[model samples]
Target chain A: MDKRAIGVFDSGLGGLTAVRRLHALMPQENIIYFGDTGRVPYGTRGRDIITKYARQDVAFLRQFDLKSIIIACNTVSAIALDLLSKENDIPIIGTVEPACRRAMTMTQTGRVGVIGTAATIRSGAYEKYLHKKDGTLDLFTQACPLFVPLVENGRVHRGDVVIETVVKEYLTPLKDAGVDTLILGCTHYPLLEEVIGDFMGPDVTLIDSGAEAANLASTQFDPNEGTGTTQYFVSDDPQGFNQLAELFLQEKVDVGAELVDISRY
Target chain B: MDKRAIGVFDSGLGGLTAVRRLHALMPQENIIYFGDTGRVPYGTRGRDIITKYARQDVAFLRQFDLKSIIIACNTVSAIALDLLSKENDIPIIGTVEPACRRAMTMTQTGRVGVIGTAATIRSGAYEKYLHKKDGTLDLFTQACPLFVPLVENGRVHRGDVVIETVVKEYLTPLKDAGVDTLILGCTHYPLLEEVIGDFMGPDVTLIDSGAEAANLASTQFDPNEGTGTTQYFVSDDPQGFNQLAELFLQEKVDVGAELVDISRY
Candidate 1:
């Protein structure tokens, strides 16, 4: 029974969705999280920068005795998962494939909508993965660039005009496309599930990509006694971490976090 | 008498506002601009991260024959101007002091409002500069964290409800405070000039900080015929550069740009 901690990270706090999922699925495993809050919205950046940041993030997490690493950021998962997975021997899980699989399984109409960051949508990772599995699947993709900042700023409530308006602007086309299954391709997108759900109606099944990946990772491990503290490390100052983490994790986590100079890694 | 290009850099395209001002004020001199679009919104990062990025940006520009450098980003101007100034013998200008001087001179009620990123507001650089200049001046500072993202997403038009709603949310208190002068502290702030001006009314003189810095730089140089090509370099791929630059530059210019891996510097 290997009890090494799981290393999960994202460009920012949005990865806490995956962390929350992991916490639920594998309550016994130690979880270490690194959020690159200092330099976020990796969605808009080019592939090289995203790859570089992903390397740095994984390297930082590699400092721990991690059995595995999770690319909780959809942008990284879409663009640099292969390069990251090859970096070490331990299994590396990305939030894309497991999510695509879930969407394919759930969609009876074979129509799937994927909404994510610009980079995630542009990478065509979800579309390629889904179409490869089932050639007849019809795929729709949209890049909701403003959603991350909106959710990060906590303007994500269903009735909020700003979030609702922005959500409608990005999601209307996908809704009209008659897609029965929608993938919340980015972890941050799930935070706006209420607004997106209210706009898309209950007919569309939304896939939480990060949680799906977390579930996949949980199924890989045997349950073990909880050991070691749930440690959090962030590239930015820890002052703003807990409040945002709580929002994404949906739980009151121990507020102690260490600040790291991630670039050195 | 200097003929070398003026090196101006921002974490992102927001500094193009300063470039526009420089281009207008000194059409003869070559203006070299570097936007670290890959790792942008430096305002939200910690002082050390911002400092490292500013140093990298300055180092990248230092590769060129630059007579002077302008810290067009208010976050960097507020936090790292002194450190950067110490780096080289060349005259370095930040967007803070000149704007503070202009705001102080323009204020009739001894009351001024400063709005910028959280870093800019938290740094208290503008307030300190103005207060140091005039002890009796009443200064109000607000941190509009969402403004950068909102403006970046091209929602700065005066009549748009999104821009108006956001502007009202941020500027109402400053308006109620009866400040006669408001500083558009960040370069991005000037992009939303029309929306901000409409919300604050024409009575409040808005200080365009980056423009003031550019104007100050222009005044320092004797008019020289246009030199070697006005080149642009960005950390991100040039595919998305020209479009956004045109948004902030406000003029049509030749868009040939070289992509640089800025982290190397």
Candidate 2:
């Protein structure tokens, strides 16, 4: 019954995939999205830094009257979600938990493969969550740090030679580990699903973290209450946000992003 | 002889290549390097945002009483170097002009290739500089935006299938044009030189922009006059900065980096 906007933030434009889902599922609830375009690819960074940045990101979004906050960046979700949830008053949902739940439902062999930034892999969030869901599940983890930059730079296409090459290299280890299900651990990894799909073959199921988070958000919030509008915000450049979002959403996003001084938060 | 440290700044660790060259040529000069690792990958952003960030980066170094400043980022050099030079009293040198000069000298067939970030290529600074030097030089330009991310993520080695594939895709047009000399217009590109070299074949000479900038700086300043001490500073994550620099520099960067709040500048 709440009409307030749901706040969502990511390291970069990959969160637009979540925004797209929110828009489709909750057309009546307002959405606030912030992409830290300036200081992106948070997955490669250290835990403390990611936590610090995530705090700032959430604090910035808090300036608006947000009902809930979504930590759309997987690295942040893995390392800082609990800290953020404990610190903030609003319901802070990270993509990790929701995506892990979805992965649990989709796995057949109980062997799950997870790919994300180095920090995410190091955190072992996916393995811990999958094991919690099913004690018998075997987890295979691979850190694909290059995927974020590749996606940000508009190399998400299936035939993109660079993406295809990197995907193969990243997936080979997990493929050899004989995992039946693969989790695109980072929000940005969904954009490379085609290349990843080709590398893992048809047998492996690809779980999109952003999509899972969006689905969870949809279940929690009632969409038919009112017409929900999306407001975009960025810490740095707002110019390329729309262009980058187009790749993820597969549609042109006309949303005008306001620039926010995230450091102030 | 002036003994003040030369200030060098980049969006991130890519500038270490310039620092590496400076260490080799001017071993005695004290160097102050500021990597905006917290808010890095300035290439894909807009000119105004890049200019603003570049100014803040320069200001951070100014606090150290620097003798000169090197704009190691190609996007900054291409778009904001002149603006920064006007604003600062200290001598400011950028990679663009020196790299362009070096490219002009190395191109044997008049057909020259330029590869950099999207913003760098869009600015057409190298093309303008090349034409200014010799109007007859045929310039071929391609924006290899993912190269920086690949380099930063430690995917730069030769025969690394991912980097090699990306290099081949990015260099195909220039290779088809029979470019005799290719300018690695961004500092990060130098890290991927091995893969770039393999893709471009042995005939094409690769111009490392950061190296040229260092050589230019060396000619103007005597490294022997300083204390040979180097200090590293970053906007966020000093530990990540140290690790990335060590990885990129291919040696232990003994100088500890201080985390400074760069947004203030």
| Candidate 2 residue runs with Cα over 4 Å from true position | A131-134, A159-161, B201-203, B244-247, B250-253
Quote each prediction's TM-score. 0.97, 0.92
Docking quality band of candidate 2, CAPRI definitions: medium
lDDT of each: 0.88, 0.85
Off by over 4 Å in 1: none
State the lDDT of candidate 1 residue by residue for A142-248, as single tens digits.
99999988888889886677888888888889899999999999999888888899999998999999999999998888876876457888988677887677898
Q: First chain TM-score in every candidate? A: 0.98, 0.96
- Quick one: best TM-score, which candidate? 1
Q: lDDT winner among the candidates?
A: 1
B109 Cα displacement, candidate 2 (Å):
4.0
- lDDT tens per residue, model 2, A138-159: 8889998777777776777877
